[model samples]
Target chain A: MSENNNYTFVIKPKRTLWEIDLKEIWRYRDLLFLLVKRDFISVYKQTILGPVWFFIQPLLITITFTIIFGQVAKISTGGAPEILFYLTGITFWNYFSSCLTSTSNTFVSNASVFGKVYFPRLIVPLSVIISNLMKLGIQLLLLLMVWVYYIINSDAVHPQIELLLMPFYLLVFALMGLGFGLIFSALTTKYRDLTFLIAFGVQLLMYASAVIFPASVVPADKQWILFLNPLVSLMEAIKYSFLGQGIFSWFYLAYSTIFTAIILVIGVLVFNKVEKGFIDTV
Target chain B: MGNIVIKAENISKQYRLGTIGTKTLANDFKRWLYTMQGKEDPFLKIGDTNDRSQKGSSEYVWALKDINFDIEQGEVIGIIGKNGAGKSTLLKILSRVTAPTTGQITVNGRMASLLEVGTGFHPELSGRENVFLNGAIMGMTKTEIRKKFDEIVDFSGVERYIDTPVKRYSSGMYVRLAFAVAAHLEPEILIVDEVLAVGDAEFQKKCLGKMKDVSGQGRTVLFVSHNMGAIQSLCSRSIYLKHGTIQQTGETDKIINYYLSHELKTEDELNLKVNKDIPACVTQVRLLNGEDQKTKAYLSGETLRFAFNIDCQAQGNYQLGIGIASALDVNIFSEVSELMELNNGTFEIDYQNIQVKLAPGNYALTFNLLYNGKSIQYCEKVINFEVLEINRMGETYSLSKGAGFLITQGKFTIN
Candidate 1:
């Protein structure tokens, strides 16, 4: 027996501070796909229009912003068509907000399952983000149609080669949403007050991110404050990349990326530690 | 054994009793501050286990305290306890659904737990989709589940409804499919907790057979159940818990004996008061025992003796009798007097209890009072007793093995 123990010593079973076996997660990928598909179908399962609600939401929001801000207040769209400009901001912001809200509530919504099983908890939040991304893709297609219509009819619209960087902007927004969502998810497991705060906080964050107005409207003195909001850099970067009209500095985008990375690291650390003991408290 | 699959040392879980809210937070913080200054947590020293059941004592109960045990591969261990006895709490801790307040549990293999069947199954998802989802939740990989998909559907007997959403399936079908998926996953360690109680008798028997098969595959199992029969039949070793403490841990029969004898205490007498008068009263009751002071659990097809004392008031030739009943109040047999018996006085009766060849189960003895051979008072469930099967002679002599609690002497030949 001693010899057998010594022979098995080569396995070196030692507990690490943070040991997340990603391969085990990969093995359950089929379940992850099924969950995402279930989320997509269940959202519109009993609805009259089915997937049409996805397009209607963004279109209605764009029209509301056009009448309230564009026609009445003359909120500048920074030389881009009002419909294209508003739809772009609303479509991307909706994806981020939905992903953030859903991911933040993952633990509370799945506590029944979590209390009874021992699966990797990361799969739930990851599937939520993926499902929201599909919704974002459909909304982006509608925005692109508006962009093409303006390009053909209006000479003031100048589509720039920088528009090819749209995917990079999407990645940044997704990372920001996931990072903040994970932090809230971990905290909400203990103090459920965070759930109520997040519902209102997501709406308040849109005002600070320049989603309703052009980034150029922020005065030179107040531009530093806009830079403090990570989503502001993300929104302005996407606007400048596509419409060629807002501030597009690599320094600001780099700062946003670094901020997102740091928060993502901290979010993972907190989430890992919280998952170990949250069932007892939750 | 070369394979020591699980090793737990001094694992104790201490939960703060009472409402877990801001007040507990304040106390926890105060305790933390004192600990930093070299003082113990003051509240931990102020309570004992006996004070736990009283109202307004903060309901501060320890669910499990100072639990330590280990198991080798292929060993099946039963956790037996009453409600609020920490059986589920210990399983939850071992299954990683919750963490202990102190100590460590070292496990050498992947563990899967069916703490409750259909835990992660989405109600809107079809049975086919739920198979994968619930399997994943129980720590089975897609490839592993895919390989067993057909077998799971066949075993559940829900093949026709596989494409239908589980919310629409009958509850029996839902549980069967859920248990099927959990059983087929085949992890190194299986933890089951009271889920078998939900299924039908046939399904429960099927589940027990599957559990036996899983253990036969050289894996470890941790089973928690309140059913002493199931525990004794399935587990070689068993642990008995009482008030969050380990009362006994050893061979299954020994632990079960301790549980059945020590833990099954019932109230001796009933105290009821009407507005104007005391309608009836219990004169005397005592548990009969052998010379060893141990309650006689069984008799060898002969009469057993019980000693009783009774006092009567305002009696008009009262008839006295004793009835033997099962725990659930189904009377097995009774002896009553048809002649004049008693008056306003005290008396004692000693008789060898007659045998009706009772089965091995929990039973109760009730005494009845009658006036002029007509029943006047009935004492319900007066004293609780247990009948155990004699095990030393032969396997066929076991009362529980379809012997119908009677010894017969008829010979039969095979066709």
Candidate 2:
């Protein structure tokens, strides 16, 4: 009990937009882990299938996507098989959408705890990102199994050397989702109308980012439209590296990087500004 | 007391009264634009006092108004206030749960608040897991929790239920487990609200003893409760708050007595308001003397009179009841009109000369309307009257509080 050290904290009504103390966040890292643990464990605990439900969601979605877009609409998958193509896209898209939605609603759902106790409010959104990563890991394993089966059975698809960039690509993607989430969640505290819009907005964003269709399928004249969407390049890059079936360009990737970096800065700034006063509004 | 651990200077918090959010984004964007232009928040200038009873002219109100105080290390300071007095808001700002709208607070050491017991406890989680989770939420690391896990379990006395899910535990066990986790956290300052009110009398005493031990170790504590006796016994100093501002701060006993005697007042009649669902209600309750007229104060040894009016839409048997409470909101005695032979649709009744051997202080009256033993409406502390000091027992004010709240007759025989 006597071992703890002193901390000199001056609490005020207002602070700079970037007055984040990374050291305090570091101190509360254990809380972050426990919260992430709670998120993942609680979601699946009561269900009989438990974590197996994680694999089933994307798998079913992929099957439906393949039937509608692949067989019925006959959308070109850039010469790769339809199932593998849709699975990879859904895997990454699932991480981003789930991360963004959870982060955006952080203030609303955790209002009860926020009202009663004080913690680094950012920990909630950060843990949501981390927890969704666990589901992504499980989904990635499912994708790897399907990828492995195709590799042994056929020579139509080959893996690219850039496949090694999978983890880095996912991190950047997660950060962008987190950034957008922080902005929306903070804003939603005062104006709750955004909560309804986000659910619809994320779905609309999936179509714009080429989640089910490849950038190559869009004609060259219309290609600028795909490039304008920052996430299209990320989606193309991930698929190009994994299945060797999507468009590739460093210029667009750099453009996506800048787009993500800007949103993240805005996200952190907005999050910091909102945390102090959101309790009253919420 | 040692060096000062917490210093709050000119603290104030403004809150929007009815609605927090702007109805549309345009109104919101204009406000944000005004903020970015370095202009004063035009909206903040518009609001009334945060009194909920009266509908104010504007949407904004100041919940806390220029609160200033300094707390010394090892001092257990009691914060006493009526409801809507801003005690909770002040504690919230001190614990950093919410920032004040103005002013600054400097804290010299790490602080933890038990604003609510079992705050983040998950129903599905085991008691042990909840302890760890709750400890981590307080900023204690895994190693710190490990060092005190056994002791916390022992103190909670829930070792038998440690492995079981908290949802299965009795409400008593749940509160004990939650409090044990908070009590074990070794922050330099601890802030507690009325969390002990949930516990039974024995547990409340144990909580007070533990708080005493915490203060004994030189930890600053800010305790808030409506219980005057608890505040007097536990705190070194006391602060009285009314309408979002401090009314007084001084020695615990003096402040407690001042707070009780000052808030308590003389009254003879109470007009109770009815809520939506209650069909039967007590609209008027009056205290009287033996002459069947309204009287303000009662002599210490006098038998009190109660006259009340019960308005019921239906003519079924209705029970009009009166409850007597101390200044601290402790219920002392209660009686129903049904027992007093007031039956049926008779809207008004008078009952006289009930034995009330009470000490000299203000006591609150609560009126109730019950139909067939079911309570339809209850108004607590609607009106209070003073019992003038006659020095019947020949004891000082301090001695009277220690002996008991009431002055009853008892025959003593020495063997």
Best candidate, lDDT: 2
The residue-level lDDT of candidate 2 at B354 comes to 56
Global Cα lDDT for candidate 2: 0.84
Superposition TM-score, candidate 2 onto the true structure: 0.87
* Candidate 2 per-residue C-alpha lDDT over A224-257 given as tens digits, one digit per residue, 9 for 90 to 100: 8889988899899999888888887889888888
Superposed by TM-score, candidate 1 places the C-alpha of residue B208 at a distance from the truth, in angstroms, of 1.6
Give all candidates' CA lDDT scores. Answer: 0.75, 0.84
Alpha-carbon runs more than 4 Å astray in model 2: A1-6, B21-27, B270-293, B299-325, B329-358, B365-383, B390-415
TM-scores, chain B, all models: 0.70, 0.78
Candidate 2 lDDT at A149 equals 91
- lDDT by residue (A73-122, candidate 1, tens digit) is 99998888888888888988898899899989888888887888766688
C-alpha lDDT of residue A208 in model 1: 84
Off by over 4 Å in 1: A1-19, B24-61, B266-353, B357-383, B387-415
